[model samples]
Target chain A: MDNYNYASFPLDMDDAVFGAFRTQAPAAGDPAPDGPVTDLATGQRAPLSALWRSGPAVIEFGSYT
Target chain B: MEDLAARLGPRGFAFAFLYVREAHPGELAGHHATFAGKCDLARRLRDRWQIARPILVDDLDGPLHAAYGMLPNMTYIVGQGGRVLYRAMWTDAASIEWACDYLQREAQERRTSKRVAPFYSELRGFRAHDQYARIFMNGLLEGGGRRAADEFVAATEATEGRAAADRLRAARQELPEARP
Candidate 1:
């Protein structure tokens, strides 16, 4: 089991926002990865990386659509 | 989070999710950008989460958010003296539960020790949470809800003490564009 410490990460909205934008969304027509996914509440386009660091995330793709 | 809030009640701790700007507004690769509808998305999420606590809307001007330097999905526990005690961001559930238990203990100990001033002393952490909830609701209404805004106007008046009505006038002065 992973031990999560709030202080370890501290709170930096800047870094989190920056890192989210750096990740690439999956390409159109790409096969969906196997798992449950939840889309971001905003219907904005986002790379798979920005979807979430871990756990389920919402997504859109050509293959799925 | 709603379940946790319910369990903790007004005495344990209140949770509020501040909806800041979208990290990735239009696309994943873009730099910080703002979205028109993202705030609504946040509202929906709060509702879906069944969060009973308040979720305040941080405006485009970013006044409140700038004050807190808040990160997404972060939780802060403010003790009875208006002091922040526990803070967590990008957390795991198990750890958060443990921290919550610890917070409850701390609140209890503070109460038992009777170290706090009477006026500032809290019997349950929930009261503070409720207060924040009321404040946040007013803020949320101020964001766009007509009734919420009206209610907030009233609340501001009440809480502002002898200057309640005057504060409303000041608030009106603060937002000139809001005038007819």
Candidate 2:
């Protein structure tokens, strides 16, 4: 697998660049094991699906990035 | 540096070291880099650097850090009105010096504008030097999970002006709307 160079992409256009680069972004119907989700502030239990949201959030998508 | 903060003064700036979850707990307490025992290593680091600023420990459960959304290691510079002026993860001699310079410039601008400030007294040099270790290392606040809701309230008031206070009161007085 070819490594993507996200650093070279401009901040404003990075999302678009990623979409084209990845070619196949996750769809709504994927049945992969749910990712572990924790409320960063409280370290409390949260829905795994809650990770996908529209808002400002610090995402640490390690290795898969 | 002590010299920098002194030149910066009480009006100029204030520094708070929020001790959150330790990356290397063992390294902090002189055991080893591996995570192990809990000890106040911030004091030792501050003393070595001759820092005169107040360093507070985060709550054992890290509620304070959670409130700020702070990650493992970061330094935040909050302005006079409690507005976060700058934030950086980790600190080094050169990085801190540049930050100090930026903060000093900000202080000068605020002074010129004559803005309302949360005033604090000038910390004495003799006291800072003598008890630097104790002040920097020991827990400043008894407990960490204090509500910074007041800070948010102040910010809202500042942005929307005095008239918004009436709206805020009404909202708090009213009940939540029932879902259909």
Candidate 3:
């Protein structure tokens, strides 16, 4: 098991102000925050670091209302 | 996303959806006030949408969502080293597919490449769900929904332009009731 501290990750949510609407994505080579997220299929809590371990990952952030 | 996953999974590409707060909460699946409530709604959404990819639920406060632009629908591509390669404000399959292709080429070249410029394409006459749209549109015409719509429109106008914002508002008038 790997212990990861999310606080160390360079995550700046404030820069992503909703109405500002960034035309560009986060810059390449910028490290992504390995925050805690729940896997709905297995009902297990894991950091994003666990998900992108193998290779490239495509993540879609959304809600089903 | 599933289609992209299927096509790219064999090529060392992984796909997943990070379920955030409700986009349009109503009687069927109302807003989640607690972490547990959000988890329950996430399960329901996975089942309802028949989502094939793994669904990850964000915390009640939605730190992940806020970190990634806080949009209702956003797409991101992370490279091998947990670096964000591409991002889209809205979920557009075509643009995403193009990004994937670009990534594949970059991977083959075995070199760190420049970020692909963002592309926007407005799909005319695209409908998510007639039944759901009717309910959501009706909801948007009301109190909280109206405010959300206004805010979204203003945001769009500020970002994209008034024409784009007005088009989004016009979408409300086109919603049709579900077939009986």
The collision pairs in model 1 are: A25-A47, A25-A48, A38-A57, A38-A58, A39-A58, B10-B126, B11-B125, B11-B126
Output candidate 3 Cα RMSD.
Answer: 8.7
Q: Model 3, range B1-180, lDDT digits (tens) per residue? A: 677788878877788999887764544555667778888877776776688988898877877776776677878788778887777677777777777887788666655655555343332224366465345455544412444445545555766777966776667666542111
Highest lDDT against the true fold, candidate? 3
Rank by lDDT, highest first.
3, 1, 2
When 2 and 3 are scored with lDDT, the better candidate is 3
Q: Rate the local accuracy (lDDT) of all candidates.
A: 0.38, 0.35, 0.66
**Tens digits of per-residue lDDT for model 1, B107-180:** 57776885643232211122234344345433333433434344445544544444754555455444533356
Candidate achieving the largest TM-score: 3
Of the candidates numbered 1 and 3, which has the greater lDDT value?
3
lDDT of 3 by residue, A1-65 (tens): 02111111112322444445464335445677669998887879989767779888888887754
Give the candidate number with the greatest DockQ.
3
True contacts kept of 2: 0.00
Tens-place lDDT per residue, model 2, A11-56, is: 2232332233223322112222233333322435443323223211
Q: Count the backbone clashes (under 3 Å) in each candidate.
A: 8, 0, 0
Candidate 2 CA-lDDT value: 0.35
* CAPRI quality band, candidate 1: incorrect
